[model samples]
Target chain A: MTLSPEQIIKLGDLAKLAVTEQEASTLAVQVDDVLKYIGRVNELETADSIGQWKDTVVNTNVWRADEVRAINEAERNELLASFPSREDDFAKTAPVFKR
Target chain B: MRANLTIEEVQNGLRAKEFSAVELTQWYQRQIKEKNPHLNAYLTLNEEALATASLVDKKISAGAKIGPLSGIPMAIKDVIVTQGIRTTAGSKILENYIPPYDATVVDKIKKQAGIILGKVNCDEFAMGSSNENSAFGPTRNSIAPDRVPGGSSGGSAVAVAADLCTYSLGTDTGGSVRQPAAFCGVVGLKPTYGRCSRYGLIAMASSFDQPGVLAKTVKDAAIVLESIAGPDRLDSSAKDKPLKKWAAEIDQDVRGMRVALPKQFLEEGLNTEVEKSVRLAAEKLTRAGAKVELVDWPLLEMALAIYYIIMPAEVSANLARFDGIRYGMTVGAEDLWSHYQQTRGQLLGPEVKRRILTGTYVLSAGYYDAYYKKADLAKKRMRQLFAQQWQKYQAVLSPTTPTTAFKIGEKTTDPMAMYLSDVYTVVANIIGAPGISVPGGTDSQKLPIGWQLMSAPWREDQMLRLAAVLEKE
Candidate 1:
């Protein structure tokens, strides 16, 4: 199944991207080819496939103890320095709502 | 110093005072200066490298024993953030972003006194198979200037192959490290997932991405892994596991070790020379007293599909941070929504955008169950299949890539074609198995072919030991 340019436009919107009509048409075909290939997963069968799904822990990584172990001064300062737009220490962003 | 020298040799040279660490660093710097313009392997050079080298030299002069990586110049993939070093991850979005702290691997390597050479180029966010997707420009194959360096670790592979550095670090989300190592004729080892901490690595598909080593020899790969692989407080995924003396363990006997050659890897689209090399490698192993057999692994074919679906799903989530709010360049648009769109659209490369969009669709409301959920189940099935294979065979061997290095721009426009390059390498990441790719031999085209080996989880010991046998010829 192919995704139309309109669907791609919708996806681009959700993804916070802006694709031109040309790119959308191209992506429509490319994305369809990928989706078609991946669709084979729907046809695959396994011995334990029936009703075996269960929610499990996401991964094996152990969580650190709950505490606020602050970063060192250099690290903190550099993180603040990387801010795209900021005043003093607070990061600045485009207004969420119109003025 | 002899060219393409291994880490051991560098250690010996320094101990014997044959060459000072400062001198060795200079040699690599000279090599980078001479070759980098043509290869585009390095995107930035560390100005403080000499200071690190001087510190190593001072330690030596004081008669203090140094670490294994002391005085060794190494390159890092740009995707791993380095404190005080410019790390762009090969995207224009992060063009001016300088990281505050080094990645866990970087910090560990620094603790071992490994001299930082510079950050190398990669496909943006480690997304593509070929280095062509790098916004900085493609890294040319060191062996053949006209050919592409298989990527997103293209610069790391090129750096090691050309002797620009003793070894380099790269990531293998899906063949980023191994493909480039194969193309450029080097050694790349992707340890079991969580073996190396992912703290400070620019996330693409968080589950699949692992920092790896690109080196001139199998043992050097082991050396790097030993230095950097361990649990970290910063990244919870890094489990507390015993770090092996990998370099020393690689010399163990391979006799009676059982190896399986997946026939699926030899099926159509595999270059004949690569197949010949793999079969010959098996024969050589047999002669070395290891058991080798051809086996049908139908499940291997389905991994690429699962990877594409799940990987893009993860990609969309990991990359949402680049919405022009916290870091990177910002576009002055009317509101936050437009700012995100304009900044990402104007900065991220086409491949990055494509994957993000595809990921958005797979995780969308209507399609989530059909694509993402199904792929998750398939991934579980693949894990079981691989676990069963490892029970009988100590390791599984395959060609690192389907073909040798292709010419520059050959697969640029074709995303699917580029994705196919990871077909053989993605299985390791999916199952969290440790993998290594050694120089199998040269194809008829004189291009290098990679002979890949995967061991059971945390079994890099047996894997590297067996790889050493193949590295003989």
Candidate 2:
């Protein structure tokens, strides 16, 4: 149940977070501690258990009329303005692939 | 001064023409200036507070009808986005992010003429049990300056307790609202999961997150809850039922109502003083005509383990949006992958990183069934168990926390120890039930202890009735 430093680094990579060697070392022990504590759940009987996807309170699907409604220009501009970097009327981002 | 007025008293004073909304806003603004420096409760202040209040005054002068929250100053946890105001969520990543729109609750409160005071501090992304995780530094408990205010709603609770605002809005993913309210000796109400719309709340654990209220009295909390709770087309998970008249039902009788005291919550590791106060509160409820009984809820013990699993899983998913491309801080790098790693690594705090990493691990390949799937099943079982108990008991009562507010830096190094602080409160969230934390009494340190009352889903009316009885006693 204990997480090793390598596993901690792997987790950080998967989570898209950078971990320094020092941080990975410290976090390895901390994550291991938490996993060991949470490991108690492993003892519970899950053989017949079915994973519940929806909340018990709001289990039904809600429907709305199929209609087209355009957002106001001002509102659309506000949303576009929230992007950190933007081209003319479009959000900009770093290059996904290099030529 | 206006700082000491309750929401009802404020409304009455406005109607009586004793003071104008502008004057009241100025008074609260002055109080924030005087107190917030030492407490660090408010991270941002609305510069237009006086203007907003004056508009309310003008409306009143025009003989326009106003809601209960008209002109009442309120603080919101930074996690709840405020249009045109910088909402940091106590993280450096979003330190400069100004939301383009108000959260659904914020929008509703504004429509009622509630004056926005400012955004209060909270743990980064509402992750930690103590406000110490705040990137801006920890908020001091108003009652005991050296102790930690239970968090991530610490600032909201402290604002209400210290009278910086008439009431404050907070979010309780676990015990963020209730625990801090207990620490600060105020009333914190966490309605059912979908009670308040989560349209613009900075998502942490999506399923467990709910907007809550921290107020000086049960009635004020009910008033705020009534204003904010209802269906919102923007939030698909929001309940479709009509909103209850909570303020109208606040004074209802609790006589002959059955309440349960789960024997598990009073076990070892619980501070003796907190245990005594909660038990005495139960006795007080009995005297107030409630039929109290001891009950066994075995599933309560598994709540913390399941929460850590499910909450982090959701956290990982929801937080993926902050991958440096959309908004917030974006550290430039050679590629998008490195951009995400560097921006999140350099910006997010350690606790947030820990949750994200652990969540990634649990939901990763080969381990999903053992951890995520199992936790989901356990959560469902816990809800079923709670429903069965509600068939007999009108509400379940326990200490809001295992102990009173701990000293600052006491549990910061030990993350597991800090996680245990929410043990008594998280079960309600897992079961998607309504819970309230009311001040029971003080511990030996004179730090306040809260007694919590949880009821079935959408049963906030009965839950508040029991809390009102306790408030009276």
lDDT of 2 by residue, A1-99 (tens): 567888888898888899999999999998888888876777778666533434543456768877887999987887787777889988777777753
List the TM values for chain B, per candidate. Answer: 0.99, 0.99
Model 2 lDDT tens row, B13-52: 8988899999898888889999999999999998878888
- Residue ranges of candidate 1 with Cα displaced over 4 Å: A46-48, A52-61, A70-76
Clashing pairs in 2: none
TM-score of the second chain in candidate 1: 0.99
Instruction: Give per-residue CA lDDT, model 1, range A12-97, as digits (tens).
Output: 99999988888889988888878888888887774355556333224444555788778988778878888889998899988998
Model 1 Cα displacement at B84 (Å)? Answer: 0.5
Give interface RMSD for all predictions: 2.0, 2.6
